[model samples]
Target: MHMSVANVVIIFSIFSSAEPYSGQPHIVFFVVDDLGWNDVGYHNSYIKTPTIDMLAKSGVRLNNYYVASHCVPSRNMLISGRHVIDIGLQHGEIGYYPRGLPLDEFTIADKLKEIGYATHLIGKWHCGCYSNHSLPHNRGFDTFFGYLGSSDDHYTHIIMSNGLADLRLNDECVGYKYFGDYSTIMYANEAKNIIAQHDENKPLFLMLAFSAVHKPIQVPDVYMQYYKSTIHDNERRTYAGMASCVDEAIANITEALENKGMLKNSVIVLTTDNGGGSVGNNWPLRGRKNSHWEGGVRGVAFVYSDLLPMDVRGTENSELMHITDWFPTLVKLGGGNPCERKNLYGVDQWEMIRGMEPSARGEVLIALDTTRKASEEYRTGPFKYDKFDITTFAAIKMGKWKLLTGDSTYRNFWDMPDPEYGVIDDEDFDDTRMVRLYDLVDDPSERTDVSEERQDIVHEMLAKLDGYEKAAVPPQMQTKPRLDNHVLECMGPWID
Candidate 1:
């Protein structure tokens, strides 16, 4: 029997209200790397993402969700539930350098573990792996089967930039054994194995962070056949194949969950770490990955669970939600208190997610890069965007207004190379203003700079940035040590 959405909402309201922490739900979080807005089949019909599309169809689509512009910062927020500035990662992402998410910060997995959930991390531990203290197992997970670096080759399982193996099972380097197996399949098999062998008595917290649809654009030839005729560009064609592999992996993982009798008591969250890269598409939205634009930080995210009220299922949530909120949200759902840790920036949005209340937050501090020095201070009077030099490159979203100051690394809008999706207009972007402001409520594409017209909002956002700047700790970036014999051996932390 099917109930109408209106009827379900009324019935739910009459019968039940938001409840306190009740029971643990198996949490399966999928963090896809560099997934674009238009990459999913639900967003863009041209792409074939049947699994994700199907899940999204039954899930609560987060239309106004936000994350950091880069991978490490985003992953840091996800794990620690703290902002980049608070965590001293405001400058940039951790690369080959020896640093990671702070050791003191309690992770989401750690909180879940406190409530007796068996936590496992299956791919891309980009939060930090500069030392044993920063590894996934140390952070909170009971088991970790993934690489400990930023990116790696899909099949070879090697960090191609330095030609070092990265595949690992717990602490042991195992990239040598899985030379030809694709990461999408490899990770899927690992997830299924974890699900199959798990003890049903304990709840599961499986974080499957896929390295798919990222760089190198590598996938099996069979997957590429799905997009051969539709996508013309070689890179995009290959990217589509990689996306398809991820979709199939999700399908298999979900089936495994069902087989394990976990699906009925599961909460599956699918989201991208950041925005898409050069090869990806975020059409009609300004800028690509690493930019302070909507395309860069506005994540493609959704939450699917049988626990969600029927009224909210398949509905789009336009309320403001940040990646950090997941910490408290999941922790509370697992019957654990998030307030046990101090200085947490995340707020529990469990009620909001279940459609029982409005969003817990109204504003989000997108990113703060304090490395760049401005020529002059922010002005109070009628200021020209060019005249006022922004010392800190930052972006903030409050209510309807969104503000960006200083240089956004990549500020150009990107569209799919195909003609039908959309075409990039050379004359569309003038690229003059560094201090840019847009009413995201109206101008999500970030085409117009409203800094001149809206001085009040500008001052408000600037004050907010100033307050955050005063509280931010110094960045933890260290000098890239000379690559020695030890570095050539594997990709785990060399400093341990």
Candidate 2:
């Protein structure tokens, strides 16, 4: 179903004949933090996501979307149209060297702003650190109302970073703490206000990046009441409640858009920033967040728009899509030519969203989670070679064939305190440390290994991975990721 360069001319005729948006289409990116594969209602989980499910039903659902396994890198790719490896913006963004997004790189907001679109970012801005020019306001957002660092206490809005508040309105720090007001609802109201007060003269490009369901697993008592019986684990139950709050927020935003008569003429993108953290279930997929597994890197994504052809809506797309594609795709949607702007690694996926092509991408340099250990990966065609230096040495996937070289006893993650999944596939056994291979098409769970029989395929894929490793730029962080303590010191005491 992949389209060739020759079919470009046919696109105009199809959309031109239909009733497209009267003017440039408004876009609202509803992005969440650490949402799991099975977290949403669409995946048949306990989590009630009626809003997300309705959006998916009315849009083109992308089933095989992928993103970086961590936070900062994923945000960087979505904004910059380049992977961390290519840009040298690798892990340890909490307080690593070369913190925040690079100044030279143009964010999606920056491109949208050039075309006279009103740009706003209303939530977590984790791509940069304090005092850096990479903050949302400095990087082309017309207005910013959110936190400026990694995960902060939702209720108090206080971060471990010097105990200062993280909330802000534009460059000025606002009331980070709201003793009783739920952060999710407060954010939802802010987005609703943005839509209500929007100037219809110009198209809107809004990124509502919510910080729900990340850590501290905090949720309002009312929201938690719904999942008390369904989820027994206290942390998981609270996490589900947090996700529900996010769901309600999305519903509110969409209703606001509809109320303002922007729904039919708008394009709304819904997804998580990355794979789920601990209280999440990547069920049916292997591995968790912080590691390069199907569960960790593959994320939930969807595009809902009445502007899209009627036939394409309510359908599923299995084509590959990386988080970086959003930068160029949104640029094109906002009436800007990304090709004419700067050199970019992402291709314009505007055509793909319209169901004109299968996928514009064939490969991706996934990520290198460089905290205390290394979780590196690169995928070409159907083959994915994941290299985790501290864990199992390497994992390769070539269509039906998957090759594993070793195993790791240390499966500890940042969010989860205990090893809860138990010894997977007897992987704690001595045999897992040796070479192995599996037919992924038949056994997606990777329960079988046929390395002894497929020695040739294993060698070929390993050679390909070696080439990628040589060209990749190692992460700049010389030390482990530490808490950012000087954020408030760097950001002045200007509470709004």
Best by lDDT: 1
Poorest 10 consecutive residues of model 1 by lDDT? 1-10
Candidates' C-alpha lDDT:
0.81, 0.70
Positional deviation of residue 241's Cα in model 1 after best superposition, in angstroms: 1.0
Kindly list the per-residue Cα lDDT of model 1 for residues 1-496, writing each as its tens digit: 1123344334334323333224678899999999988889899887888778867877799999999888988998898888878888777657766667788889999999998999999999888776878889988999999998788999999888778899888889899899998998999999999999998668999999999888978988887888778877777888988898898888778777766767767899999988888778887677778887888999999998878887888899888899999998999888998867567788888788788998999899998777875544432235434233354578999988899876654656557445245546546544444567899888888777888888888877887877888788899866765335354688777675
Report the alpha-carbon TM-score of model 2 versus the true structure: 0.83
lDDT of 2 by residue, 1-496 (tens): 1122223223223332345686788999988898887788888557787778777876888876778778888888888887676666665554533356667788888889999899999988877653446678889899998887677778877765457677888767676345456678878989999999998667999999998878868988888888877776777778888888888788778767766867667889987877776677766666677656666777899998868888898899877778889998988887887666457778888788889876787555555333332233312212333342323244444455545443322222222222234324433344324345566567665555565567677666666546555665666554643334454342322222
Report the error of model 2 at residue 191, Å. 0.5
For candidate 1, give the lDDT of residue 345: 81
Judged by TM-score, which candidate is best? 1
- The residue pairs in collision within model 2 are 100-128
TM-score for each candidate, following the candidate numbering: 0.91, 0.83
lDDT, residue 478, model 2: 41
Name every residue pair that clashes in candidate 1: none
